[model samples]
Target: MANRSWLPYSISGEIVRGFGRGSNELGFPTANYPSSVVDALPDSFECGIYYGWAKVNEYPVYPMVLSLGYNPFYNNTKKTMEIHILHNFSNDLYGSHMTVVMIGFLREEKSFKSTEDLIDAIEQDIAIAKEMLQKAECLRLKESFSYDL
Candidate 1:
C-alpha cells in the first residue's frame, strides 16, 4: 500500500472541482482518491469486471468501469488504474471522491489484434456487463418484492 495521509475529504463528498485524463490512452474519466484510502484498500483487489458506484458531486454514477490491469498494447506495465465511464455521461470529476464498489468480474484482461478489435471487444463486454447488472438488479428487486409481501 502507498504510504500517505488521509485526504481532507471523504467518500460521497461534494465535488469541488473536476478534470479529465486518458489513463493509458483509454480515455478513462479517472478520479483522484485520497492516498490514504487508496492505501487502505486491499492489495488483492480483483482486476476483472466489477460493478460499482462513483459520486460526482455526491451523486451515484452507476454502470461505470473500474480497471486495474496492465495495458499490454499501450504499456507493458501491470496494475494501472483505469476506468471508462459508461452511458455517455461525461463531466469533469477531478477533486471529487469517486468510490467504486466492486460488483462482479467479467473476464481477465488480454490483448487484441488491433485497437478497433479491442474496442469491439469492449463493446461486447459492456453488453455482457449490462446484462449481468440487470440480472443482479432484478434479483434484488425480487428479494425486496418478496419481503414487501
Candidate 2:
C-alpha cells in the first residue's frame, strides 16, 4: 500500500445541496461541501474515493465513503467533495455542519458506461469502506480532533 501521508486529513463545513442523483438514482444519499471547502484541499489530495469517519453537528460519528473529484460520469465541471455517511437518517442534513477525517483511499474515481455500472462501483466502494473502517487504526480516527462527537 502507498504511504498514507494524507491519513487523518480533516475538514469541516456545512453540507450543501448536490446534483440530487445520489439518492434518487444511486440509492445512496450524499452530503456535499461548498466550493470553498473543496478548494481548501491540499494539492497532494488525489481525486478518488476514500473511507473515513464523519460527524454531523452533534450527531454520533459514523463510517463514511467520500468521492472527491469532478464526477466524470456526470461530466461535472467543478470538483466536488461528496460524502455518504453509512447510517440511515430520518431527515435531510443540508446546511448541517459536518466534519470528516479521511482515513484511507479506496479507489480512483472513474467514468462508467452506464448508471448501473456506477452504482455497482459505488456499492463495492461502500462494502470496502465498511470493512476497512473496522480496522483498529481507522476506528481510532473517530477520536481525532476533526470530529466534535
Candidate 3:
C-alpha cells in the first residue's frame, strides 16, 4: 500500500453520465465524477481499484468499489473515477451529488482478455470492499463529519 497519506481521502462532486456499459454490459451501475474532479486528483495518487464508503445526496452511506484510472480493458483515452455503490437503487442518480471517503486500495487497474474476466475482477473487488468496510475504523469514517450522510 503506497501513499498511505492519501487514505480516507474525501471528495464530493456531481454524478455525471458515463459510457453506460457499467450497467448495460457489466451489470454494475457506477456513478462517475466530472473530469474536473478527476483532474484535481493528486499527481502522486495511486491509480487503482479502491474500497470506500459513499453517499448520494442525503442517503445513508454504503460500501463501494472505485476505479481510478483510464480503464485499460475499455482502452479509455481519459482518466475516470468510477464508483459502484454496493446498494441497489431503483432509479438513476446521474445528477445527484455524490461524496466518497476512499479508505483502502484493492488492486491496480488491469486489462482482461474478455469482458467476463473484467466483470469477475470487479465482483471480487466488491467482495473485498464489503469485508474491509466492516472494520471499526471504516465504519467510524462512514459516520464521520466528512460524509455528512
Q: Identify the leading candidate in terms of TM-score.
A: 3
TM-score of 3: 0.94
- What lDDT tens digits, residue by residue, belong to model 3 across residues 68-102? 99999999999999999999888889899998989
Pairs of residues at least 3 apart in sequence or in different chains that clash in candidate 3: none
Where's the lowest-lDDT run of ten residues in candidate 3? 140-149
Q: Please, what are the lDDT tens digits per residue for candidate 2 over residues 1-149?
A: 43458776888999999999999999999999999999988777788899898889878888999999989999899999999999998998999999888888888889999999999999999998999888887766676644444
Runs of candidate 2 exceeding 4 Å displacement: 1-4, 145-149
**All candidates in order of lDDT, best leading:** 3, 2, 1
Error of 3 at 140 (Å): 1.1
Tens digit of per-residue lDDT, candidate 1, span 1-149: 32213211123332232223343434444454443543455565544444344434445345555555565555544345444556455556656555444445666677777776766766776777667656765346434433433
Clash list (residue pairs), candidate 1: 18-94, 19-94, 49-106, 51-103
Clashes of each: 4, 0, 0
lDDT for model 1 comes to 0.49
TM-score of 2: 0.92
lDDT to native, each model = 0.49, 0.89, 0.90
